[model samples]
Target chain A: MTTASRATRNATSRPGGRSARVRDQVLEAVQAELADTGYDGLTIDGVAARSGVHRTTIYRRWKTVAGLLVDLLEAGVDDTWAPADTGSLEADLVALNREVREALSGDSSVTLAVIAASFRTPEAAEALTRFWDDRYERSAVVVERAITRGEVPGDTAAARVVMAATSPLYHQLVLRRSRMSRAEADQYARDSAAAAIAGLLRH
Target chain B: MTTASRATRNATSRPGGRSARVRDQVLEAVQAELADTGYDGLTIDGVAARSGVHRTTIYRRWKTVAGLLVDLLEAGVDDTWAPADTGSLEADLVALNREVREALSGDSSVTLAVIAASFRTPEAAEALTRFWDDRYERSAVVVERAITRGEVPGDTAAARVVMAATSPLYHQLVLRRSRMSRAEADQYARDSAAAAIAGLLRH
Candidate 1:
């Protein structure tokens, strides 16, 4: 998996070129198949046909349905995406959780589809793990800035703070399958921030 | 789904009777099928063959594979299972989270099977929702006792605390597919408990 991930990283060296364009077209097709028919219906042939790329190329690179999903997840780790500087940990967390809520909502949520795919494939699960690890790293800056401003202790584990803030949204929407309200979603952010402020999330 | 659930409740009245025996047999078969080959491989005909319960009776009562799964979850709400009286909220939560980790750990985890089933079918989702509602009610006693012991605020949302304690384990194991250690698993229980003690998870 690391070798495949490394290959994916190397592929990024050719941004906005022919290889990148092909990758985009194929991943778009993967999402369409997942949205319309889910993981059970996704196939290399289908993806190749839909993307107008040859199946030989998909097989040589992706090798499996999981390959396309892994690359799709790699594409999700956008360099431009970051949490807003809300000047308060709680407010920022509220904003972050709301973003997660937006991702999980709707009938044909691509994030939900990806999550469902991960449940069915080990490679997809690994890709999702890497994706979240990157996300946690990106979001940890919120707590670092809070520490600079004297909002939370320097010893606070920033990733745990992010996990507390976002875990509840996934808990309610994904695991519980409940129709969680915005207020309910926001409270979890407050909970994590309050916990961090109290020095309970210390390393 | 509610009507089907209602029918399931009615079937429970005749405890240890013929109907009860048939349910036990069919549900046992459902677990077997789910463990051996997940939701995609499950079929009413397969259950009929495995359980030796007539197919007509299964079709009449259970109606679908989801029906069998719903009853299987109902059967899991055992009267004998209760959190240990560890005499502290954090410890009790650790005990509870440990139990969840155990359920989700094994190679052929039936809880995982049921969770996967929930993602594929609306009825299974409803059944799982009801199942967790019951578990939450049962687990809430730990929080109530904590309030009485003055370990946390009187207005603490016990279920939210429970969700906090458990959600991280699910997030890491199911979503991230990370192999979390028992110590790592225990930390989340502590995290949730600390948040509650800080008066953060207030209703």
Candidate 2:
């Protein structure tokens, strides 16, 4: 399907009215603009024009450009929930890493753009915090399950496990100065998962 | 000591001519600007005016604001290295983490400002890569020594361990909305060091 069609489908899937639709359109426009022009070049007027929404409506929902961008990130980025009982902690963790890798690599432009803008805006920082916190919460459930199954120590801090498992992928994205290929992502996922499992078992 | 006295002393320590002093003054002015106005508000002309150095002299050493800023970061940030000879991996790791925290909390506005600017500049991104790699190399010595001493598994990747020890601070600086305080930095260092040691032992 075309990108616009996919966005339309996504918008329709959510329960909302005309205002919500306008918001979604604006967000979609913003994402597209980010991919095309990057964070430094994205403009509110351009988003208003592309979304076919009134500037007043955009302003009402998100007062600042940073605020609008943060809202878009919150709405568009998919949060990975905890893995189901895979009968083994290793299997569950691998599944979790795969999901994170897919999410990061699939929409990398959006992620990078948000990161670029985040340096300048408090709202963007808040969005990033929410994003990381959501991932941590979901991954924590898997770690907690491992502890319950006696695969890991009962007193393990699940959040640290999650951080250890996913930090390398983030490091690659922001600090490595290179795009993350699928193969590289897979390797990072496997290695980090193993390291986290090893950590948990030791405790 | 007064800032000028320190600068004069540094100038006398180096074997450079008047031009070098001009460059140093301009760079110092840029650092002061970063602390006062932040990365977004920094300007080349402002540095020249603040330092009473010619704009041409400033541009001669560093091509752009980003380049100048990156140089400032590289010059200011010391490699906080520690040897892993404590016999126990956990003890070694705690010492390493303490050093990292101390360096991060020190009066190093140039490094912090450059990190902020990296979110916007490709040049800054490249500089960040080199900076992090240098840091990793220093931390790697500790990890390698641990492996040789049988405190950690021989197969352990020093790069991963170093990254884990450092990632949380960067994560907080970039993604979290809250300002990282000394207490938080200390807690993170302790927790991360403990978790990494536990993981190493498991392997």
Candidate 3:
């Protein structure tokens, strides 16, 4: 999986060319297939047919279905959906909520498939765990900034702060299967921010 | 699925007799098979052999793999793991969190299978949705009691309180694949309770 991921990360050597276009098209096809069939049922041949990319090319590049999915998962997580650094914690959290709402609510099947795949195999689980751990660590900076500004206690748990802000949206989207409108996201942001400010997130 | 669930619900007709024992053995076999093969690869015949129950009996009763899985899901959800009414919002939430943590953390594979099956079919999705909605509604009573005690506003959303209190456990267990400890659950309960008390859960 690491080798394949390295290949994908470096595959952009031909960025801005026909190769990049083909890569984007194939990744799009992969997402569509994931939404339709999930990880268990996904196949390289199916992706080839859907993307009009040759099977030989997909095989040569990705090497396996899990490899292809790892790449897709990485891309999904690396799409630059960063939390805002607004001067105020409340506004920053609201911006972060909106970004997450848009990212996840767009295609829930992808996340579900990743979850399914994660439990099915150790490699997949490691990949998914890394994706989230990285995201959480990166996003915890917002809480750190809040702490620096004295909006929250110095001992506040940054990861917990971020998790408090975002878990409800994930809960609604994945477990509850409910819609997360901007108003709902706003409510969550406000509530979680209030909780953080009150020192509820401190260890 | 409904008829099978009805049968399982009333399977105690021959309490302490062959009928009850058969039901237990069959459900145990279903969970074992679900854990081993997952819903995609599970089969009625496989469950029959594992349980040593006649295939005809299983088919006559459960009718489909999804039906059997649904019954197992219902029984899992219907277990006597109600949220505690400990006369305080914080204590009740802590009790609820412990119950949920114990239930879900007992067998990760079973929940993963339900999630996998849910995304595979509309019926499974409906069953999963119903399971969570029922659990949420049932557990919201703790927050309602808090309102009555004047610990929180009357307009505080009970479901939201419950969701806020419990979503982190689910998020960690299912999505993040992180280890959930008793301390973590306690922290979540306290933080969510504080948020509710601060009127963050209104509406």
Candidate 4:
């Protein structure tokens, strides 16, 4: 679950216990450090100081920088979006498009930094792959729902269709150094759904 | 012009010219250095030593690491492919796809390393932007040719069509850490053309 829900759960089950508080503080500190200093500049001592947590505790729980970042990314993957159960496939894909656009555009540089780091190291690569896999799996539900509603073919590759809708945005943001306007994102969504309807994403 | 054509021109016009030879060696050294030790580890001194050219000449001509790389990348942008005017839009887009796939898969890691570096530095960012713009311009011709041949609509965005055909391969290679076969490339081409023909790419 996302930190917001996790916090809610902590309040009900444990009433602001020390361990839950520590975890919240540490993760908050990590987010701040990632924003301020970026991935390369972050250090355990800095995080410990910022979080008011002990170095031993941080090291014992997270073995390396990659480990910490991986956990942070995993924590980020908790689903905050669901496919629009709208009557039409076009509208549902557009809803899915906006969800992805908002998520990436928030703290865009920080997200890009983590992605760039993934290219340089195997540990980071694995973590980033897992993060993307989680996203694709979540987005795939949208396609599956559309299929079940009889809006698309049963044998369509859900993730591939999702990738078709979103890859252009990612490409523009990361490599082309451009932002995807809402209009552009909507167009991409519509085009990708049209392609799926044309049976391009069939299994 | 690309290195090969530049070398050929130099040989015929000014045979065995020292300046042309020096230019060739310096760029060759840069490529080797980029492959052996990534962008961060490369140094002018190392390139100068490897190329057997004076440090002063290297500094005077290229000035900085980014300068050398930018020049090298620009040299790589010379036109080498033409859209197969095979009277079928499907054949033309497929041909364009193979060109991109070959260029990218040749030194995939090195290309990604440069792209990753772009996110961190302004100089690298400019070079990478130019590199992509050149590729897009070159490929846009394919779409334009198809339009002239009355294959696609006049209002279709040529570069966007090209981006559709190639962006997934880039996403898979760089972010998803996946390999793409020739079959996959061909499929992407066909799907993108199908989308365009359906009027999805029309402006």
lDDT (Cα, tens digit) per residue for candidate 4, span A56-123 = 99999987777777766665554353456777767877877776566456453456656766756677
For candidate 3, the per-residue lDDT at B69 reads 74
> What overall lDDT goes with each candidate model?
0.79, 0.61, 0.75, 0.70
- When summed lDDT is taken over every stretch of 10 residues in candidate 3 chain B, the lowest stretch is B1-10
**lDDT for B186 (candidate 4):** 85
DockQ of predicted model 3: 0.60
Going through the candidates in order, state the TM-score of chain A alone for each one: 0.84, 0.76, 0.77, 0.79
- Write the residue-wise lDDT of candidate 3 on B1-203 in tens digits: 11112223444443668866877778878877876777777899999999999999998988888888777767646554356789899999998888767655644366666776776666777777777776777787898899899999999998778878888887887777788999998889988898888877798
Residue pairs in candidate 2 whose N, alpha carbon or C atoms collide under 3 angstroms: A199-B199
Q: What's the TM for model 1?
A: 0.83
> Which scores better on DockQ, 2 or 4?
4
Model 1 chain B poorest ten-residue lDDT run: B1-10
Question: Where does model 4 exceed 4 Å of error?
Answer: A1-21, A77-87, A106-108, B1-20, B77-87, B106-109
Give the lDDT of residue B116 in candidate 1.
Answer: 76
Model 3, span A1-203: residue lDDT tens = 11112223444443678877787767777777877887777999999999999999999988888887777767645554455678988898888888767656654356666666775666777778788777777788888889899999999888777778788888788766878789988888888888889877787
Q: Which residue pairs come into collision in candidate 4?
A: none
What lDDT score goes with residue B123 in model 2? 78
TM-score of each: 0.83, 0.78, 0.83, 0.84
What lDDT tens digits, residue by residue, belong to model 1 across residues A47-103? 988999999999998899888888888876643457878999999999888888887
Docking class of 2: acceptable
What's the DockQ for every one of the candidates?
0.63, 0.37, 0.60, 0.61
Point out the higher-scoring one by lDDT: 1 or 3: 1
